[model samples]
Target: MTGADDRGIEHGLPADGPSPSALARERRENAADVLASTLETRDATAFVHAGRGREPSIRYCCESMPHGRTAVAYDGTTDEWLVRSADASDGHPAADLAATLADRGPEGTILTPPHVPHDAALYLENAGFEVASTEAIARARATKTTGECDRIAVAQRAASAGIRRAASVLADAAIVDGRLAVEDGNGDTVPLTPARLRIAIDEAIVGAGAFPAGNTAVNPETVSHPDTDADREALRPDESIVLAATPRGPSGYYGGLVRTLVVDSDGGRERRVHVAVTQSFRSARSLLTAGSASVHTVAADLEAEVRSFGLDDSDEVEATVSGVGLESCEGPIDGSDEIEPGAVVRLDVAARVDETSRLRIADVVVVTDEGERPDRLAAPAHSLSPAALLER
Candidate 1:
């Protein structure tokens, strides 16, 4: 089967008029508009949740029609969802939509998200239309469709594979000059830097039929827990290394996973932190019951679990309960939003054991109906010992 990239170039389109990247972006925008327009037509309610400034909405309409839908053009100025109507002339889209609306007569009020543009809101108000803040769009997005959930699961599986590959490399790596070194394909030992591990992670995700969509961090010095970059830092023996991967599936859905491993450790503060994080992750997962709990409740419960581990609020511990879908961080389910059955959420926790040691773990879970437990997509064993991961 031809891959997405291969199909992009199969058309043999001219490269001068618009770069491939630009054309892809335009296609996405057009698709998003179409989605918004379709929804508006069905409900007669226009939603505004554009990107920055005068930019378009990134959620209500998506670039890819993985949900099997057509694309259209969205106009924020008139708070209109415009599509290529059968009677549309070869003129401005905004004008065409206005004419169409006039012919059909106004039906419902225009709804705007929290971050709608001021001018657009003003236009709707002056046109004698009531504009209200409705989280319906965001709430609808949080409840993933069956196809969306499947795509997320695929990405999560890919992310887990990538992290597992990194662990394999770490388990067999030789501590050379306080840095991890592994034998290359030609049987020559080479120092394994953050960059090299990152490449390995990306390759693993691709091998699993997905793309590395988010940040891939391989931190040798787990204590400092510095942001993963291209730095060629040495890997010390008996130290913890944090590996976090977020991969995107072919359907434009994302999944995330994070794990910490120690090489030949004597089971000290790092190990303690790992145990605490694992317990906290389990605790958070238990709270993802449909129609009963919200992410706000989960976040509070997770923090309490962390404190019960003898870590203070001031400790360098971070725990977040966020919804994950097309975007790595989607609509966070606060106190107002319930944990719906189809919601896909990520519980991420990171803590600094001491000045130079840290541990982190994350997992993606799908909320299910009553009598059914939440489904965990990434199933790698969360172990602190490198040998345990290697054995798998």
Candidate 2:
């Protein structure tokens, strides 16, 4: 039965999408199927977990977690999850869960995630339940559910707002003495730097009701990563700025959007790199058709496409295409494995121009069923100038 999550925010999903309680029901049932398969394979009695959930909510149980940490199990027999409420003062998480399960019912082989604490496993063993680890839960989360997609789409709106805010700031700045500067509300002149730009972007994201933790990059050099102390430096004309928006929505789902822009350009190498990365985004987005290709193949194809434009990404860069969900990078596409449908992935393509210069464009995209093209999370397209891009 579906229950309320007092801790969960009412993200107000679209009318056609599942409600929070409905989505929670779908998640646990879907997770139960995977757990049942694992139980059959391992001949286990039930699956128990302790400590934190992979996601803030939507754990095996649907009730509001009253504890700092929660523990729940799946028996695959009932629609309900095996949950035992315990306080932190009682003991550690593993001890609490072990004690809770010990008194509840018969003890047998129990499965868990690989990272389950040693003490937790030991406590379970001491309590007469054999504990083993399985990758089933992780596997289940990789494929985006219908409700998860809708939640991510809500997050995407916030990301788009942040990107637009950042672009608007860059587009309105004036080139004074070769330095980019902007006027305050009082009409006082101030230098437009990454530090200033990040504040505007983050505020915009927060105003849109999303967490801006993942969208830290503002300078060209920090495109794919976090901000640096050097980001405090003043921006100069004709330099590329990578404005990224990777915010987490109220639903705990993440959204990603990145665009490289220049205040003014002499039509130099920055333009070439921008063009290359943009094409990489388009081509990589195409190759991520669900069931038609693997992310590994798409990354390789992206490399070749960027190479065709005389620009190349560094080995240090992450996989050009990777699944996104509760975490920013999910499933870590590293090998030749076919991507499943309903997988939401981030396409991050960057070209290295030197030690201090790089250009990148990234977007969150979802793979559709076979023979259909993938879809982008946001609508804005790439442009060399922030002004023209924001105008769209």
Candidate 3:
């Protein structure tokens, strides 16, 4: 099921004179060589420490150079890392970069980073270098190493602390005229806005030694507008609230968590939506295991469970199962790659309850070889009542 190009390091010139396909393959290889060399030079002094204080001097295969005009390249065959710096003494950085690469043998085809700036990519192509995507390098990083998992766990703890702090704020809030308000240290009742809640969550995350990398959404359930900005809304009594956080640890690994809370309510439609999402989340989590399932199969099972509750389809629900590590969302479950052991992933389920409100629940899970339930990172209770969250 793999092609010649897919066979890494196997591609080579044909026995006969190079055909167009063979020439293209050669170009790709040359490009890879250049990129690898560049990455080495950029990370020359880099060392990634593993868990338990073990340092493994590992280098990344692709990295952007600190200088804007030039990129680095690594030729695997020669084992040489070369830096192509722009001769900008004359003040033409782009032109200098182009000339530098042009003089270094055939430009062949160049592989660019996924998020490369458009101008940069265009410049390479204009300089006779065919531009290609570097997704393979990204896909290779989907499975987490032992050290990466440890980093992710640290971020998850920070994310949990943030959510818990926000929950505490909600629990002690007083409902005045249906709007939730909190008394300040001076005992003055102040209306709780979405911004205030977000501040509390962000502060908690930073206090726990993590960066608030993702948006903090504190949405009130009573608002019927789907696009209602959370920052502009006020928390209301007897309604559900959604709290979601993604915090990045010191190692730059991310952890995500989302939970729904309800004030003293009769547990009406909100409860039903919460139950459905929780079930779908569990179903999706169960499907993530090493070598047992693909992203597509997991997504299918999750969508099916959501539909069984008579909720909207996957499109409307925004159901997501994605790898979480360096990036908040990476290697979507629907990707062609199969789940691998040590892959940390997040299962996020959100369904609209009405025009004004939606219910969402998410948790990070780790794929293990044992085939048991994946390790849940954010182990806090999924749903909490106002009184329960208020408890010290």
Candidate 4:
């Protein structure tokens, strides 16, 4: 497979695009447009309780918002958007929403997300407004706008950077005691452990101006607990170190990348699985172009191919596929198994190669209107070879 050096790392996003506030308004209006379509009457109001103890649907409606803000948008009217704190002194954000609709704004039925605050639900019901929960916002959020796409791209780049940093670290390390280690300034060696590697990858994500989601994992993974030190084993030569990173961009979006890195090849089961997973990645990505049908079929075929290569763990151990966006998993792709334009899907081919080592190659990609190629946002080295991550 072609490496990052030959293909070149994806550069930074365009600097002089729309400001974050402008981007938020665009998302709000876009969400409102979807909300409008669901309402039976023209005067109905949809109140989305987002962030701060609520469903994080806030991310779909706006790029950034004050903590505890509730969204009240009118049916078919993008002109009026209310994002206010759910003041405790006043009624809850939901109660406030009901009051606002009755006293001043639209005068009809009310719509909210399926997971609404109990207080908010009660208040809306008591206000004599016909209230109901809908998946309209979630469905709307699955389709990314131009601004949303740009924000997610930045995140994807950060995720790629995290993986590259790990692979590069392995490439640069010197083998000591049959395990990879790097010499400290004091000449002591800091052996590569899962926790140590996780820190390295997280630092790279932060350096790229993104926040690590605290799920940076190293398989055959290094884990530490105050109660025990059982999982502090060092990575030995020729063993696979699967790096799975999720980094949150500055704009509250997330990017995902999962790749397996090995210090040296023993030509074992792990290596064979890596090749199969890489090919499966290519085949699955090719089928995800815009307007393509059969996401379920594609997912089934991809999983079947990976399983045929002799790796099997249930869904709890490996997510064969998921949608990547504001909150890691949301989608028409995952929900309905439909290929949606502007949707970012994580085609994760993960399975346990052996008890100690697992093989995974997951990439987050954007489904575009283009028929041939879906955009690989900030993708890193597809090759399992550590040298592939280094720049020429």
Candidate 5:
């Protein structure tokens, strides 16, 4: 919940605090304070138009539901703040005229604009909020406090658990009766159909005390049908399914996890190849404590480790290592040195299994400080067998 700090102004609490969204306004106010301080060094009135959240946070957090757009103007001259909006938060839309005309309803004179707050900067400009230049607000969000970092860690744990469980369900998996079948907790059969599987995994994530934000499936390269469009098609026996999910803790901080799997019957060479990939994942996890390793270092190290698997030439493998946070796939550290503290990153690596060409195996990681090693966030890497295990 929002509380007055020593400054005696109500402010948002960090992730470990009792309320996430309740404190969002406080956090935004702190950000505005930073803006104001910076503005004080210059000579311009700062007017900010913030969009509604997609979720349901009071101001903006995990709850991003946008209530159109809201405007906040800081008048340097008057030393006053003004808030305005077109939505109900400000005023309700006129009633529906068509419904009233048809006698089907009593509403009339609808006045809803397509997208509010959608053009905040433009709106501010129209209302006279001008500046010499625009700068990115990302810096304010980059580094994290100890509490924010802790909350991120918890979110990462939740995401990791979800991916690991999905991987288990893929092990020893096969297409049966137009559905990927697996044994469940009750020894009853479970179907791995796309939509059904998504629902089940989402339930698993929530059961672990987190929430799943999104799900998607893709196929590239194939064993049974490597060169054909079949590889890009839906799951069948011995195919790979990639699942990515973001989990949020009770606090609003978030982390990302991704899983790549190959359905197999006997788990022969395919299993060995997957096991090798898993080992590389473990190696990356071991290195995550590396302090200030640039995005480049993370990517290079992951590529090197994946090559350690020794399946094919570099041309045969494709993968990416990136940053994760409030938004999944934050960005690729690429080659910029220094990911800095408070940043959580996921290093990904993948490969195909010879002529079979099954694209299989992937993992999630976090970066953290480890003595001289740059701080990185990553989960413990584990091998994949041909069996699905339920994760708490």
Candidate 6:
């Protein structure tokens, strides 16, 4: 239950260490080494398609992994890679990849992701390449190298700092000043009204050099918009706001943080909601050091903790926590899955006390093996004590 201030450090990252770009490069190199050694003994290749359209790059196989690609590639003999384009004039990045491989002229070429799509796997099949499946790809990506662990550590630190900034922002505002407010994407004013502290919390994330990647304000009257825009515009005060901030560090790699904030009127219902949510948050954090729990275990404990408080009439609302990393909602965590080291998971806890208010808490953390347990992260757990909240 100790707050970040009580810990006497800022998000627990090594800010003065090597530059993020350097760290990222080292991580990539380390991952490549692992892949090469493994693949040389086995038989496989990495196929990558990354970034958005127009800027996207695609490659079927590589001797070493692509510089910025988080995925790793295994070793192949011949030293030559190939490039075969369905349409040469199109100038696709995949074509370039084919060219790179052909230039190397490996002993034998494999067709990976042969059905990927235009500029993705289209040219691969035309060039006599074969395909790999979803499960095979997942297993390859799941294993992390030593360098990746180091970079992930740094990323977790960055995300934790961003979350702290968001929490700090909400902590600083007061309802006395005619409702200090911030504008949403639609330009609608979300009042920083007392009990509706999420408005301030959202603004805090923005102040920390990040964007709100997702939003959910579900209430009893939760404006169910058959249309998406209207539902986004009218979030009731009682609603829960699940906000995600993905910040791009100097190295161009992303670190993510997600938190839940809600506003509720002052009353017994509000108190209950706060207690339930606070308890759930505590239960999830307990998993961070216990090491006995998997990512799924963390989610299960949260549900059990909330249920023990008897807040919800039914357990219809399932998981509030998920795997978070380069992407905000990384998966395979909220179910019967395990969380590996260097995985960053964000826990979202929400409880509706009554019709007018709700309580939500989001905490960012990294899954580590540093403690006596399997999961550890640099970020602190979400805890709201009267003294902690009231303090500067």
Clash counts for all predictions: 4, 0, 13, 1, 35, 17
**Which order, best to worst by TM-score?**
2, 4, 1, 3, 5, 6
Worst 10 residues of 2 by lDDT: 1-10
Per-residue CA lDDT of model 4 for 1-392, tens digit only, reads 11111111112333422567677677777777777677644345555454452344764554445446464444344446655466642645656656666666555567777776677777767877777777787777877778778877877887888888888788888888898887656988887777677778888887787778665777734343411253356777687777888876666677888888787877777677777777777777777753654557667767766766666555213435666766777675553467667777778876666666677788877777757677778887777788975652
**Decreasing lDDT order of the candidates:** 2, 4, 1, 3, 5, 6
What lDDT does model 4 reach? 0.67
Best candidate (score: TM-score): 2
Worst 10 residues of 5 by lDDT: 1-10
Candidate 3 residue-pair clash tally: 13
What are the TM-scores, per candidate, against the unseen true structure? 0.76, 0.86, 0.69, 0.85, 0.62, 0.61
Model 4 misplaced regions, further than 4 Å? 1-17, 41-55, 62-64, 69-71, 77-79, 87-89, 105-107, 220-231, 293-295, 308-319, 333-335
Candidate closer to the true structure by lDDT (higher is better), 3 or 5: 3
Local distance difference test values of all predictions, in order = 0.65, 0.70, 0.62, 0.67, 0.48, 0.44
Q: lDDT of model 2 at residue 134? A: 83
Give the Cα-based TM-score of candidate 1 against the true structure. 0.76
Measured on C-alpha atoms, candidate 1 has an lDDT of 0.65
The count of residue-pair clashes in candidate 2 stands at: 0
Model 5's alpha-carbon lDDT is: 0.48
User: Which digits, one per residue and each the tens of the lDDT, describe model 1 over residues 322-389?
Assistant: 88876778865565566778788888888887777677888888888864778888658898766697
Worst ten in a row by lDDT for model 1: 64-73
Candidate 3 lDDT, 1-392, residue by residue in tens:
11121121112322212333443233344434444654354432111111111111111222221233443444333454444334432533434454556565654665555565576566666777666655444544566655567667877888888888888888888889889999877999998877787778888887776777545567634433324565656777766688888876654567899887876767766777777788887777666642457777776777678778877543357677789865678774555667777678888777776666777888898888856778898546776474564453
Residue-by-residue lDDT tens digits, candidate 2, 1-392: 00231223434423324676777776777777778888888888777776665443335344443355556777644434765444643666666667766776756788888876677678789989877888777767767778888878877777888888888888888888889899987999998878788878887877776677645568645533334556766787777777777777666677888877777777766776667667776776666643557767888877777778764444233337777876667763655645777778787887765576667778888888876788887646688787888778
| lDDT per residue (tens digit) for residues 6-124 in model 5 | 11111232344434444454445544555565556654444233444332222322122234444333333444444444463433111111112224221212111123333443433
